[model samples]
Target: MRIPGPEPRADGGVGAVAAAGGLHRYQLWLHAEYGPVVRFQLPGAETAVSVADPVLLEATAHIDKRPERLFEFLAPLCEAGNLQVLPTAEHTPWRRLLLSVLAGRPSHERHFGQFAALATDLADRWAGQGDREPVALQKDLTTLSLRMIGAYALGGDAADPDKVVTAFEEVLTEHLGRLYQVPVPGTEEERARRAAQALAHLRATVDRVIAAHRSGGRTDRSDLIGALVEAGERPARIRDTVMITMLAAHHTTGVAVSWTLHLLGRHPEVAERVAGELDRVLGERPVPDYADLRRLPYLDMVVKEAMRLYPPGPYGARETTEALVLGDYEVPAGTVIFYPFWAVHMNPDHWPDPEKFVPERFLPEEVAKRPRLAYIPFGIGPRSCEGAGLAMVEAELVLAVLLKRFRFRPAPGHEVTPIERFVLWAADDIHMLVSPRVA
Candidate 1:
């Protein structure tokens, strides 16, 4: 069966769809108009098949090679190799090492204090602002997430956290903004130069952290940098690994929290429930800690539902390694299989009233009724994000802290728009007026 798609444009095929900054919407339209299996083009690949049906996705779940050309923009950030495209043999061990650290509950507990303190700092700042000021949700949360990741993963202060995050933001802004642009904008030349500078600064900072780890004989050898050093990894590998982890780690968690807050702000009743949960769980504490995670089921559901609507990394791609049959269609090896989480989350067949913000949909009882793949804010199968646990813990903790301390309401006249920039992000940023919580 021939997969359907929009008419291919002469200048760039379907590249304009992505470049237009509505790839998610376009994909949804494609599915709605053409059915679950739709074909489209990305800059280098002309025949990418986007599979939205959960049952169909299971057929391609084992295909784990990320589409190389599509991920090339991130190539510059790594040195050991394009971490995203490492072969299964090499990728397996690397992923295992990451899982040992990033997915460990012990590591999260060790770093929980640092994460809570950083979140509380932001809450304190907002509380001090007297409740009426507009808070730039993405900007502040991204910074907070970076700080927490830096402290736990790279040893933030020892790594010059401020400079590292600034350089990273510059690098990402420069590269991600140019992701779909063709014929390269004239102004990108200068931006490219700045991106290079930012990259240099980042490498220098990572090198310094590695050096400190080596020379200090530090007692706190539990951080990611220390674990890497103890494992005898190469300096360049360590640098790239740190950058890659930072690249994946920071934005998703931060963006998740921002979107959750944005959704909660628009849905005051849900916000009230979240706040009530926070209050009941920790009567006087300003933030949720490691142990408090299990006690806040409502907060967990709220975060899960928010992610369903605005997944931080909205889509994932896999290049088929072998021919596979998917829902009556035989897809050949080398086909790019696009798994759009946003589309799956909104599939009317799986989710009733998919666009509505209903945290109850994620309650344990409700969740058990759906297909496992039906709610993968984190991608499914082996290639799913290793830091999923950490991101959730961080997001929930931050949400509890902020909501307990403040009530967020949408600032008048400001619109929040989601765009794909590596991660799904608000184009103008989620702006909200903060006020001290009454209860």
Candidate 2:
């Protein structure tokens, strides 16, 4: 079947996509203009097929191989192997290990108190500031998420949390910001040098943590480092795993909550409902624990709806291993299939007034009316985010704690723009005025 898309410009199809601004924006336009399946060209690959329909995705869901070329940006960070493009034989075991640790409720429960305490520490700081200036919502929240993950995974706080966060940001900005660019000798070499330094700093930090765990300086085999060491994972592999875990777990949860707060800022009514739920459920408790999550359904809906609008990772891709048919389109072996979740989340067919913020849209009855894959903020199938459960728990708890204590309003004149930076993040960072809630 012939796939419809924009005609390739003189520079080529990839150039056309760039002219459309960003990949997410181009995908949205392609789906709107040419229906669910649109074929477009990339630099080295043949025509890539992008499927926007959630139902159509099921046919390709079982294909678990990631596009190696698409993930090469992560190559520098990993020494044991290209962690981002592990062979199926290798990926399965690695993913299974991560799932065993990340998916289990016990791991989350074991660390819930730490997570709550860390979140409260930030809230306490905000209270101290007392609106001296609007909190850099995304910046501070991202730092908090990183700290939570590090403490949970390593079983303690980093020796220098700020340094670690700074290192990670430098590495990501250097590598991810110019993912597909051709190398310029001098400029590229300088970027690589800085990236390498940043990567070294991160690796050093993880190395210290692992060393502590191994020598009995710290003993928490239930934590990720101890668990992996127990499982006999090599030092390099453990370090790589720690780096990747830090990268994956941090910004996504932070961005999700930031966007939710932004939406609630716009809709005071929804904010009131979230505050009400938190007040009734949490009462005198300043933060939530594992059990409290069940009692806060509206807060859950608000987080879910926020994710639907601004999913941490805007899109994911799977390279077709065998010929597959999605709708009327046939995707041949080796074709890269792009799943544009932002577009799917905004698909008008499944969501009425898709752009509007409406938490009730996630109410059980309303959710049941839509297709199962229609709202894939964390993705679907085997390759979906393994931290989905952990992220939700972390997000819901943090939201409950922060909202229960202080109400967030977008600082006047600050505009929040969602941009793809590995994860969807506000362009200049989200700024919110923090105020103490009257009891």
Candidate 3:
């Protein structure tokens, strides 16, 4: 669709998206300017015309009303043909129907306790690890989050957590890195070979896990995969759908949880406040349950703030089905509409003092001040994240349990910077010095 004329000016060339003032400046545009909707062309390829307008940010999750097609920029990762990226088809119902499990009150309650317990275990480990020790924050958080999803929510065996974690991590990062780039830069034949090999590896690993479950079957817990198999509509599609959820539910939560930990450690007052909340709600309890999650409002707010500051999957894009208009500019079909969430979350207009770590901003009164779509962590609308509830429960419990047991201080001389990978990651590898609490 066309919008205002953001055509190339004669006097100067438009900078590439990576260098286009970066996320720091884009955040300003999202809040203060509202809609610069700058035209960004990925270097060396004619993938599609990209837009960054929030006005046109319609929620496209509805199967019948399909907003637009998921753009190819998310390819390879989108290659799994997961429900998130699936074209509107018979499988569309799967995405909708699956929501019942993710929704409903008790599922949320069931998960909160699991999350709190895991968080406590993690904190206890951290508390015992001495202040001077180097705790690889990302690895720890990612492992814990993934395990929680696989074992508790999605119900995979927690017995071999490390093996599953490694396989999951590898498959995710490998595909994610490739998907981030435009047109596989390597030679065609070579690229094809690599792609085949990677997909085969991923499918095989996932299949083996599936087979193991089939042979042995569930003891007491059921994972998302189990739900998919039991549902049994489109077997192939359903399997792929569950796999994609695993990948999404896997790393995104980990990155978010890690970011929260680093932020809390760096800002001790926030940690202290989080600890105080735990004291009032948790008392001497070993862990929290789904019921206890609601009581930890401060922890919830902290995660909400963390997500705004640093989104798990920073952006998403959709392709226009046919030529249409966006604002003042006339656009053609195939244009990729890019929504830079990281940029939007940091906008001061939407969020006061955007850069600060202020969980209090998520308090009911503070949240009431903003628009509905303004504070999207799991994203906005129906097609938003299916695992949002699962992610939140996992995070809150982890934060609460950890805060109750230990205090983390940022290691001196360690510069933690966010590097834009397929997903935003702590470039310096988020190292937090661990120390046991006196109590």
Candidate 4:
């Protein structure tokens, strides 16, 4: 059967996407009007097929290639290649190497102390802000995430953490702003120059870290650059890997924690449950250790539920290398397969009242009832984020720290609106009044 979607628009799909608020909302509209699978015009890819059914997604899960054009926006960030769209032959091994470091418990344990200190610092700063001033959760939390990831990827003393954070933000603001057509400060030429310079500084920072690894003769698996060097990765590739790792980890983790706070602020009862869990799990403690994470299941559930509602990276895309059948639809080779993650999470068939903020939905028993892909905030299949485990660790730790110390309420008169950027960002930023909790 031919897939269903809206009529082709004259301006390729940009106008429709804008009309629907953003791509996330547009996907929801398309799926609701059509069915689980819809054919639509995606600006860069031209014609693309979006699959919202979790079960249907399994057919395309093994396809390892990403559509190069769609992800070309990120090409400037890498020197070896755009890591996102690397060919399978090169990507498979690269992915395996990254997973070895990023997905391991040893690495997380080694970095836990640093991550906790960074999070606690942010909380302390927020504490000093006083309850009268609202904190910009997205801005502040994303900065915190950049610091954590910088420390994780480049090591504690390898680079100036503040400089790395500033450079990365400069580069990201320029590229993402251009892609979204959001007006960034400065002229086009000036913005491009600034982005190029920032990108160079970041690359040099990675190079310096790599040099330190080689000179120190340290080959610990827990160390990202060290592992890459030990694995015999070339300087360019190693630099690219660090750049990509930082790029991937930076905004996503911060937004995950920020969005969680945004949800918890609006849902005090749920927030109370999360706070209760934190208190019971880490009584008399200000922050959670690595061991304390697993024990705080309710907090984990709250983070998961919040991710389902406002996924950090709301959507992903893959390209078909061969003919594939998604349910009744047989898509030809080279087809663009869009994964509308938000739509899948909101699919009412699996999630009852999918819009509600109910952490119990993630209770072990409830999750077992749904398809595996039904709750994919990270993504699905081979090309899914290698940093999933670490992202969860970082997000949960930050949430545990903040939720344990304070109660967050939405700032009066401020609106929280979700807009699709590199990640799901609040259009005006999530402003919340954070007051300390009474012991």
Highest lDDT scorer: 4
In model 2, the worst 10-residue window by lDDT is 177-186
Ranking by lDDT: 4, 1, 2, 3
Put down candidate 4 lDDT per residue, 327-428, tens digits, no spaces: 888899999999999999999988889899899998999989999899888888889999999999999999999988999999999988899988989999
lDDT of 1 by residue, 88-127 (tens): 9988888888788888888888889888888988888888
lDDT, residue 236, model 3: 54
Candidate 4: the clashing residue pairs are none
Most accurate candidate by TM-score? 4
Whole-model lDDT values for every prediction: 0.84, 0.84, 0.62, 0.92
TM-score of 2: 0.93
The TM-score between candidate 3 and the true structure equals: 0.80
Q: What tens digits encode model 2's per-residue C-alpha lDDT throughout 1-439?
A: 7778777655557766667766777878889999988887754455678888888988988988889887887888889988877888988888998888888888888899989999999899999999759989899898899888877766664788778877887787777667745343457778778878989988887888778777874444357887887777888999899888887887888888888888988898889988988888878888876998999999999999999988899998889899998878787898998889999999999999999998899888998998889999887777888889999999998898888988888899988777667788787999989899875
Ranking by TM-score: 4, 1, 2, 3
Per-residue C-alpha lDDT of model 3 across residues 132-183, encoded as one tens digit per residue: 7788888788788777765553354344656556656655554554655434
List the candidates' TM-scores in order: 0.94, 0.93, 0.80, 0.98
Local error of candidate 1 at residue 321 (angstroms): 0.9
Return whichever of 1 and 3 wins on lDDT. Answer: 1
